[model samples]
Target: MSPQPQAAVGAPLSRVDGRLKVTGKADYTADHDVRGAVHAVVVGSRVALGRITALDIRAALAQPGVLRVISHLDAPRLAYRDNPGAFMDPPVGERLRVFQDDRVRFCGQPVAVVVARTLEAARHAAHLVRVSYRAERPSTDLTAPDLPVNDPLPPQDYERGTPKEALAAAEVRLEAVYRLARVHHNAMEPHATIARWDGDRLIVWDKTQWVQGTQNELAAVFGIPPDSVRVISPFVGGAFGNAARVWPHSTIAALAARVTGLPVKLVLTREQLYHGVGYRPAYTYTLRLGSDRRGRLAGMVHGIRAETSAYEHFLEGTVTPGRMLYATPHVGQTYRTVPLDVNTPTYMRGPGYATAAFAVESALDELAHELGIDPIEMRLRNETAQDPSNGLPFSTRRLRECLRVGAGAFHWDRRAPAPRATRDGDWLIGTGVAVGCYDTLRLGAQARVRLDADGTALVESASSDMGPGTYTSMTQLAADALGLNMRKVTFRLGDSLMPGSPPHAGSLTMASVGSAVQDGCDRLRRQAIGLAVGDEGSPLYGAEDDDVVVLGGRLRVRGNPARTETYERLLARNHRTHLEVLGSFTPPSEPERSSMYAFGATFAEVAVDARLGMVRVRRMLGVYDAGRIISPKLAESQALGAMVGGIGQALLEHTVTDHRDGRIVNANLTDYLVPVNADVPDLRAIYLDGGADLDAAPIGVKGLGEVVAVGVAPAVANAVFHATGRRVRDLPITVEALL
Candidate 1:
C-alpha cells in the first residue's frame, strides 16, 4: 500500500492568521492608531458638469475645531505633472487635478476637504463648506449616440476565416445584443488612507492592493523619491479590485496632512465610495453566432461597447475568449470604449472574462436551444484540446474532465429538456451550466528568509494576503522547503520596507511569490546542511550531502533516525549565528505560443417564483481543474466566496447612476443591494486531483481566484432562462424584466 503524503502542500490547513483576524487582533488600515491624527472629510460637487464660480469657507472656518478648509480657490498650487505612473491611466484631459481646478467633470467630484480635530467636527465643517458652480448638462448615459468612442489599449482583432462569409453560408444563425449594468467592487471595506509625513519621508497606511503602486504614486504626487514614501497595509477587509489603484482619496489624505502638518485620516463614507474609485464599466455586447443542425459552432462575431470616463479610456479584455475558447474556424471581434462623464473603470475580479463570458456562454446556450441540443453536449463537441486561436497545445487542460465531473455531480441528465417544465409549488426549478476560463498570470516577486540559531525561521515579503490565506500558504511553502515544522516558521508581508514583491492581484501571489519563498527557504536549508556536514565538531560530519536530510528541525542521515542532531545543537557547535538567504522569482520574458489558463464549470440550480420576479439559487456546484490544490479548506472557502459574489452579480449587485446630474442613486449598501447571508445557498466545490506541467511556474499551480466567477453569472442566467422561456440579456435580472 502507498504511504500517506507529507502534511505540507496539499493539507487542509487553516489560515495561519485566522485567529488574528477573528479575534480583532489584525490591524486593518483604519484600525491603526496614528498619534496626533486629525479627521478629514471631503466636500463633493453637487453638479455633475460645471466650473466652480465661487467658493465660501467662512462658515466652515468659523466652526469649532475646524483646522483648515482647502479648495481649488484656497489650496496651494503644486507642480501638476502628466505622469501615467501616478494616476490609474494617463490623465485623459490635462488631468482633472482635485482642488487644483474648479471644473467638475462628474458629480461627487471632490471640490474641497475639511480637516478638524474630531470626526463629528469634520463632518459638520464639510457640510458647512459651500461652493457655487456654473452648471452644464453632462452626458452620463453610455448608450447615448453622442458619446465619443476612445481606444486606450491597443486595438485587438482576431480572425481565422471570414466570419461574414461563414455566416452567409451557414445553415442557421442568430444575432442578439446583451447589456451589463455598471457595477462597483463594493468591498466590505471602504477606501481609507491615513497619511503622515516624518521630515521629508511620507508614511501612509492605506487599504490598497498594490502597495508599491501606491508608493510610486504618492512619491510622484509629492515630487519626492520613491524611497521616501512608505505604504503599509498589514490587513485588508476586502478589495475585489476596488482598492487595486491609488484612488483620489489617498491623494486628498496626503494633501490634508501636508497642509495641516499632522497625520490625517480620510475614510470614504459608503456614499462617497461610488465615485471616489473605479468600477466595472457598463457594457453593450452584440453577438452573432452560426452553428450546424448538430449544434457545432461554425462562426462567431462579437461587437462590444463599454463605458469609460471622458478624461480617461478604460479598456477591458472583451475579445479574449472569442479568440481562444472554442474550435470555431470563423471568428471576428471588435471592442470599443465609449467615454462618458463618469469616473474611469478599472480591473475588477475576472475583469473582461466575467463580462464576456456572460454574453458568450449565454449565446452558446441560446444556440443550443435553437438546435434542440443539450448544452453540455454542445460544449463537449466544440471543445478544442489546443487553443484554437494560436494553434498551440496547452500545458495541461482538463476542461473536458471538468465538464464530465460537473455533469455527474450536478445530475445534468435529470434536467428537463424544455423551459418552465420543472416546477415545485409555484417555483420554477431549472438547472444550467457554463464554462469558466481565466489565463494564468505571474509577475516577478522577491522574498527574504532567515533561519535563526534557535531553530525558528522568518520569511518576509511586500506582497499582501487580502483575505486569501497568503501568510499561511507562504508559511507552508517555506516550512516544507526548509524541512521545518509549520509552527517553527513565521511569514510576514504587507509592508513596503520588506523585500520587493509584486502586486497581490491577478491571482499570481501563489505562483510568483510562493516560488520566491520556497527558493529562499531552500537556500537557507542548504546552507545549514553545509555547515552541519562540513564541520568536524558537528554530528554527521562525514555524511554525504545527499544522504544528509533535515526533518523536524534536525539534521540526520537517511535511514538513521536516532543518529541525528538538532539544528540548534549543530549551529551552536559550529558557532554559526544564523543562516539567511534572499531570493527572487521573475516570470518568463518571451510570450508563449499557446495559452495557459485555469478552467472550471459552474452548475447552478435556481428556483424562480412565477408570480413575483424573484430568483433564488437553490444549489451550486463548481468543478475546477486549477492544478494542485494547496489548501483544501481555504480553496473551498475561496471558491464559495466567489460563487456568492457571482450570485450577487447575477441577481443583486448594480450601481444606479442618476444621469441627470451624474449622481449615483444607489451609493450606500442599503440602496445598492448585495447578497446577504439569507441569499447564499448550498455550494459544493471540487478540485481535480492532479498537477499541471511545471513550465509556467515552479509550483505547478494555476490561479483559481478569478476563474471561480467567470462563468457563474451565465450559469445562473441560463438557469433562469430554463425556468422561464423569456430571455433577459440585461444584468441584475430584475422583477420588471421577468414581469
Candidate 2:
C-alpha cells in the first residue's frame, strides 16, 4: 500500500502558538493565577560541604507577612522514598531529600525555606535567617573523581576482540587525553514551581519538560499516592534538559505548601541555578587508538571518569559511540561516574553522546592526518552498515549520504592537505567535518481526542514544549490525519491531568507521543465515516469504508466529490453531540528487528589568527539524515540551535567552580560565557528528502533534536586544527593552548 499523502506535516508552517507568545497571551509556569497563592524563597547553605552548626530564625519570624519558616530543625522528616522517576536508569542510589538532614553534600544546597505573603518579604526574611556551618574542604576537582561507588550500567567493562594484542601489533598508534569543562544548560526561563494543597490532593504548576516525572517524584518522596499530585506546565520559555528532572526546589515547594496549609511558590535565582539544578559534569577521557597504516582501525580503548554527587551515581551512554560509531575489530570501554561533593548531574541536550563524540571524532581527525587521508574519506572507510557492538543491521543509516551532501555544499575540494598551508594574510582559513549519531528511542504513549459537532477537535496528552514546537507539530499531525484545517484543531499538553507520557528529552516526542495523536485522529475520522455511510439519509450511504475519505471537514467518496456530507449535518441528523475516542501507541515489547538511530554530518569553517591565537567561526553547515521532517521550520531551528550549542562547547562555554570550596564561581550570565549573536555564523541545515524511518514509528520520523549537536564541538575543534598548526587536547581550545 502507498503511504498517506501529507498536507501539513512536511510544510514549513509557523508555530500555532507563535501569535499568543508574541502577544504575551501564553501563560508560563509562574504566570498562572492561583487563588490565595504566596511567595516561598529558599535559603541555601553557604558551605560547600560540612554540617550545619547553628540556625537562628528569631529575626526572620519578626518580619511582617512571614507565615512560617521550615528547616531541618523544625520541619517534619519526610519519608524520602526511592523511585526511578527522574531519569534514573537503574536506580543506583537514594535521591536527595529536601530539609531532611543537616549534612551539606554540595555548596548552595537548600537548607531552609522562608514563606511570606509577598516575594519581597520572603527575600528579606530569608536573609535575616542566619545560618552557620563548620565547613570541610570539598573534593570538587574534576581531575579524578572518587570511583566505583555504584555503576548502574551493565557491562561496566566491555571487550569485543583482543584490543591489547591489536594495539601492540598496530603499525601506527595515537594516544591522548581529551578534557571537557563542566557545562550548564542556561535556558531562557528560570525554574519555577507553585504547589497548592486542597485536603489530601496537591496541584502544582511547574517548569518541567516531564510532568509525569514530577508527579512520580512528588508521590514517591512524600509517600503519597501518585494520583494525589497533579503537575501542570502548559508553556515553557526554553528547556534543553535542565527541566527534565524533579529537582530539590520542586519537592520543597510541595512540602512547604502542605506544612503551611496554603499555596506556596518557589523560584530559583540565577546563582542557585548553578548548583541547584543538574549540569553536565566535567569529564576527563583518556583514549588510545591503534590503526593500520591505511587508517583502518585495529583497536580502540576508552578510560573515562566523570563527576557526580555523593548521594546518587549518574551515568550516560558515553561508551556506546566508541564501541559502535566506527568498525574496529578490537574495542574495550569502561565508563565510571566518580562520586564528588556536588549536585547530581543529569541529561543535558545530547548528553553522553556529545561528550563521547568530542574525544572520538577529534581522535579520528588526528589519525587521518597521520595517514595523509582526507578527514571525510577517513571516516567513510570505516563506516559499516551494521553496528559493530551488537552486530544488528541498521533500519536506515544515511550517514554516508549526509557526509556527501555536506561536503558538496561546503566545497570540500578547495582545501590544503597540510595544516597552516591555507592562510589569508592575518587570518588562516580552513574547513573540517565530523559525523554525529543518536539512537532513536521510542516508548508507549496515549492521547485523548474529542471532536465536537461543529467540526472542531481537542487533543490532550501529558507532554511538553520547551522551545520546541510541540503544539504546532501535534496540530499538524491531527490536521493531516482527520483531514481538518490547521485552525480547526486544538492540542493541549504539559498537564499531568492528561494521559500518561514519557520524558520529553531524547528526541522521542515525535515518534512516541506523535504516533498516539495520529492514532486518535484516525479513530475519530473512522467514527464519522461510519456514521455517514450507515445512515440512510446520507449522500453516500452504500460506500465502503476505504472508499470514503475526509476533506475540509466534509466526508466524500474517493471518486465522487458530489457525494459528500458535512460533519455538522451528519451529527445533527444522528442526534449526537460529539464524538470522543482514546488513542494509544505501545512500542513493541519484542526485540527490534533492526537497530534504529538518527545520523548527521556537521561541516565547519574557521579562521584562526596564527600570531594572536584567536579563532573565529565564519560559517558552518549541517546535513542531517534524521528520519522525517515533522515541521520544516522547527527542524531548521533545531539544527541552527544545535550548531550554536556546538560552537559554545568548542570555543566559549564553561562553568568555572572554585575547587577549594566546591562553589560555582561564575554562576550568573555576566561571569559565565555563552555564544551571543556576534559569535554565531552563517549557519545552514539540509535534511534529506523522503528520509523517513518507517520501522521506527507510524509517522516515519527518527528524531532530530539530539543528533544535531552530537558532533558539533569536534567539527569546530578539527577546523581550528586545520587553520593553525596546533592540536589542543582540551576543550574550549584557549589562547594559551595555541601559543
Per-prediction TM-score to the true structure, in the order listed? 0.97, 0.98
How well is each residue in 649-690 modelled by candidate 1, as lDDT tens digits? Answer: 899888887888898999989989999999999999999997
Index of the highest-lDDT prediction: 2
Q: Write the per-residue lDDT of candidate 2 for residues 1-739, one digit (tens) a residue.
A: 1123478989999999999999999999888889999999999888789999999999999999999989999887787677765563633677777888889998899999999999999999999999999999887777843445445545467899999889999999999999999889988789999999989898999999999989988888888898999999999988888888889999999999999999998988988888888988789998999998889999998998888887888888788788888889899887777778888888888989999999999999999998999999999999999989899998898889999999899999888888888988999987888898998889889999988989898999999999879999999999888888899999999999899788888999999999999999899888888888899999979888888878788888887889998888999899888999989898888888888889899999999887898888999999988998989999999999999988988998888878888878899999788899998999999999888898899889998999999989999999999988688888887878887
Q: Lowest-lDDT window of 10 residues in candidate 2?
A: 144-153
Residue pairs with backbone atoms closer than 3 Å in model 1 (clashes): none
Alpha-carbon local distance difference test for all models: 0.85, 0.88
Q: Which candidate leads the pack in TM-score?
A: 2
Question: What would the TM-score be for candidate 2 when compared with the true structure?
Answer: 0.98
* lDDT of model 1, residue 105: 82
